[model samples]
Target: MADPLSVSANVAGLIGLANEVGKIPVNYASNVKSAHEDAHCLQKELTALCHVLEQMRSLLREEKLQGTRFEETAALVSVLGFTNHQVNELYKKLDKLSIQANKNKLADFWERIRWPLKKDECDKAMEEMRRLAQYFQFSLTAANRLDFLSQTK
Candidate 1:
């Protein structure tokens, strides 16, 4: 990668974007403006992901820092890569669900859901939440591991 620090920064940005995207009521995007906005945000997140991929490719190009020797880095990159893919998939699903949602029903349900923990009623929303949680899980694991690994060096 460009550097471990750069990769970590990009991943942190990705996580923040994913967190925001997860909270958006994509399924309730009943208008062109909302969907368009969500799409724009997603595009920005994808651009960040692309930057991370480029950094990884740069790392691979380094003959002195051959990828095989950096086992922990490789593992972290792999997990982060998967998390990135999952984030994209979740975004697409959310947008599609939002477009297909009954906004009136969703609005009423969301209002009530806010008062209660009845998130299961909205399958798509639940899925987004689940993926968001997974992202956090991965981020924490990597953060802890990175900290420990860096300290040893």
Candidate 2:
């Protein structure tokens, strides 16, 4: 497993890249092409960084680390201009979905729903919301809910 410090450093690097990408000028004359290219590259790097963060988070969970890195990652992402309100809202929706998905009584209701249609509906509802949902899923699955709740500070 990678060192936790190294993982944190990588996440910080990605956050820096995202900041750089945000600073690219939209109307620069001579440097427009290069700026666009750099922005694209940074976007790719950010995506990869998100994946790495997920892996590191999983490792942290498996090791039973008393401290969590999810909130730290979320804070970094939020600091990068991802709105906290949006993240919280998405999490609420996901909590509802998880409840709906796991409910025994809802099993019959889910079954009675049309297959692709229901899926498409759910997908549409979840569109632009998967990132937060996935983040929450990772955090919840890796650690106990009480542990996670206690770390909210």
Q: Which candidate number maximizes TM-score?
A: 1
Top-scoring candidate (lDDT)? 1
Q: Which 10 residues in a row give candidate 2 its minimum summed lDDT?
A: 21-30
Where model 1 places Cα greater than 4 Å from the true spot, the runs are 26-73, 97-153
Q: For each candidate, give its TM-score against the true structure.
A: 0.38, 0.27
The local distance difference test score of each candidate is 0.50, 0.41
> Model 1 over residues 20-59: C-alpha lDDT tens digits?
5544443234333334344344444444444444444444
- Cα lDDT, model 1, residue 150: 86
Tell me the tens digit of each residue's lDDT in model 2 across 7-106.
4555455444433332332222123333333333323433443454455445444555535343444543453235234333423432332233445766
Candidate 2, which segments miss by more than 4 Å at Cα? 25-153
- What local lDDT score does residue 134 receive in model 2, on the 0 to 100 scale? 60
